[model samples]
Target: MPKYIMILLSIWLIVIDRCSGVSSPIKPFTLYKNSTELKNDTADLWWTINDAWKEITFELHIKSADWIIGLGISSAGGMKGVDIVVGWVESSSKVYLQYAVPSTNTTYHGKIYKAPTGYSIKRHAIAHKMLIDPKNVNLVHHLKLYECDPMTTLNDDQLPDGLCDEIVDEIKFCSLNFATVWAVGGDAMREFPEEAGCGIGGDYEIKYYMIQMHYDNSRLDSSTASIPSALTVPPRMEQFAIDSYCPSEVTRNIPKSGNNVIFALPHTHLQRISVWTKIIRNNAAMQYLFNSEKYDFNYQYENRLLKSIKLYPGDSCATRCIYNTKNKDKITSGCERTRDEMCLHMFTYYPRMNNFYACITVNDDSAGVLWIQLR
Candidate 1:
């Protein structure tokens, strides 16, 4: 080949090799403040390489901050016999240490290292602590070998049950941002506590849970039954109210005797029901009796006459009533005193201008009658 062509080919090969996973020297990482007045105290480190290198090292520089309290590593595939070297600079001197983490059979491994030196060593491993001043630290570097794949032949059975449990515990303790869990084998099941064990008020309580089950659909046998069903709160309990409608569609008749009373109707619908009270005094004519001039009337063919009380659909005996006037006056005043006293009725309906009405009742004699007309 021509001399120039040979040189160009060599350069291209080197570039390709690097791109195709050639191991290289340690990469320098840095942390900086967004504002000079406010400090950034959090950081994340990620290691991603398919091949195993001769040695891996991490160097850190921090200023005006406390020591790094913990360290963690996650294996996307699987890793074994991994060794790490950590080093730091303190009081103008360098401190370092080495540690090994056994390959986890299930999930990722998290280890914490305490300060190795009385003055807070600059670097340590597994569970070690390192000290650095936020203003003085300047350089952080990671060095790793780049030659052999460390996670190519991992299998599910190689993982330990405790590994998965550990992962869950970490997620619970550290408040991790994201997590993913997978189940292996046909018989394995994942479980979590229904209530947080801390016994605190803000603790998480998992009432209803759903999990996706995945298997080879084609391999499913016609005779093979599905996993037993789990106990779940009824859909009606979650999405709809148990007692949605109040004063259920029963009739209520206010008697001639004035009395303070409270009424309630059960509601099951998840929506809010409006309960209204209407006084229909015995006028010479029904039209004059319901006219707006005599009373602030909002009478609907179904449940409009009584406008203040609302009865949700699922409520049961959820209605309430209280008489405001004295017994003799209430029975004798406003056309309600005669054999046909003013009829006080209660109705429940939605807020729409003309929605389907749910329940209504008219007062008769000394009692009230409630009726459910929704069918």
Candidate 2:
């Protein structure tokens, strides 16, 4: 073989090895930042820890104007529901830590069960409400085979009469309840396993973990941020895995109400305006899981909660994603293509158990396709 050809072949093999997870470094944590010129950018710091480093401590720093920065442990990528400890700098430069858990429907089997007999009252959709009552218990009730049309102009008559608890089978996303796990803050040394029985035990193992940082360059044009983060462990402990709640659909819209963990939804391009996921309890109380008022397609991250929110059997998870359909001038449906729109919610949460799954009203169509080929 030619001298140049041999050199190229060697480089190619090295690249292949790195891509195949063969060269993944065994480290406590790794830093990741976007090299792009975009002012609003993100940095994802991953931790490839195994059973050897189960109990460890983490220390982090942000270079400048730290609007959104955090350390997270995930099963998949950063976008998937991960157990993240997020922090934001206030106007007084005080940083506060909030435990965020991504919501996924996949963790709850992502299925909708039928309403038993005597469950009639009808389901209400996510229609526009000009005048909403603060104590209104009708809008957030569980619906039986309910449909929410994004373009529909909702009037007072379209709203539900009162709380409807007809549905029997609904998936609950209560596994990612780790508010008491470990506390994190700015420039502070935080320990994972603070003491004995502090870390996650059993068959759970952390396959992938990452730390993501978001820099906001709005007021200070040239201001910068940097975080010197670290994690230390005793070298041998059982690891735990983190999973999310993502419910996808090639067809059908989200149902009205059920006891499901509906966290966040995914959209492509400029069609989406906002996405809101809420939990409607049996007493007619409302709790928001994830809310993205100004949805941006460029920065598509799961809407996470500061703490884990539980859902009972009768409670339903509701999601509403608005779009700008007026510009297209054509009827749109769900598809993978860019021109088409998708109502898929990448639900993210924790506690990877056999019963966790999504609660969409339709059956998944992508199950039959082979995993090797490209989508």
Candidate 3:
């Protein structure tokens, strides 16, 4: 063990021994002389003292010729010019005396002193003021004092003027007067949707939904401006065209016995236009009953086709066709059709409850198919 650890262990052992009821002998000494000398009662223990001081020492006799000892000093007037010397017979000696004068209020106030070995000693003074109520303040007098406001009830009728008056009422009157002036000048704004809601047929039922796009169209070519011409109705609708007198120009795909179909379409460009060709099929024979064009060829802007349509799901009738125009001018002009103009039908038909697939062919001939669930 290290020397310091050994010394600590010895001190701990001494404390433990005393707590366990083992008592060591204490020797008292008075320092009326300038110096005092301590004698070692055993060979293993030694002691010495220098200078004037009143103190006591303790000695413990352990094994033969071995001893443990301690020293203490006490004085009613406080010790002065005192020195305590300690050593073992064959060990090193150490001085445990301080050569310092106790500080006095006037002598050491706000001053610093150094030891003989140049170690500095510092003294500080702290001043404090006691406050009973720190937040008590008077604004008019510009002073802080311990005062508190008494608790009181509030009366709404006694409130200050303009503190709680009807500001909103004034604003409403101004708005109405401005609107009346506008109406008198024939410059009134159009009826808002909320106002129009009450007058139309006594509360009509309106449903709103969004069509979400399911495919990416970043690869479409901007320059290809021609719609395909080889638009064909699904092959299963051939017989329905004869029975229903539906013109061959329209082809409709209806389910023979189901209530819904999973329809899918490809993401097409904004310039792409499409038409809905209706095909009426004979439910009994599963044959095409009629084929007809129910609506004008509708120009399908990329935005409309890519957006999902939210029609009445189970029994809704769709008579719209989508078409794309290569010419920007034609697109802007609502897909004007010429005498010899031709367009493609970009749709896939299947039974109402079956899976439906639709594809869009880009100018680069790259096509992508999308699947959609119909209810």
RMSD of each: 28.0, 24.2, 40.9
Error of 1 at 30 (Å): 11
In model 2, which regions exceed 4 Å deviation?
1-269, 283-285, 363-375
User: Model 2: which ten-residue window has the lowest total lDDT?
Assistant: 2-11
Q: What is the lDDT of residue 259 in candidate 2?
A: 24
lDDT of candidates 1 onward, in order: 0.23, 0.33, 0.22
Q: Is candidate 1 or candidate 2 better by lDDT?
A: 2
Compared with the true structure, what per-residue lDDT tens digits does model 1 show for residues 1-375? Answer: 111110000111112222122122333353221111112332323222223652223323233222322222323222232223333334444444323223321112332111112322222111212232333122111111111111222233332122223544422322211111221111112122221111111212211111111122222223322221111112222121111122422323222232222221221111112222332222211121122211211211221232233333322333221112221221212221111112222222222211232344333455544344431
| C-alpha lDDT of residue 336 in model 3 | 14
What digit string (tens of lDDT, one per residue) describes model 2 on residues 133-219? 234222111111221221223233332221112211111111112111101111112222211121122322311111111111122
What lDDT, from 0 to 1, does candidate 2 have? 0.33
Stretches of candidate 1 off by over 4 Å are 1-48, 51-61, 64-70, 76-89, 101-375
lDDT of 3 by residue, 1-375 (tens): 212211101211122122122222433242122211222332222223332643223332322211223332323223342322222221333323211211211111011111122223322112112221223211011111110111212233332111012333322211110000110011112222221111111121111111111111223323323344323222222111111122211222334343322122221123333334333333222321112233232222111122222212222222333433433332222111121132323221222112232222223334432222221
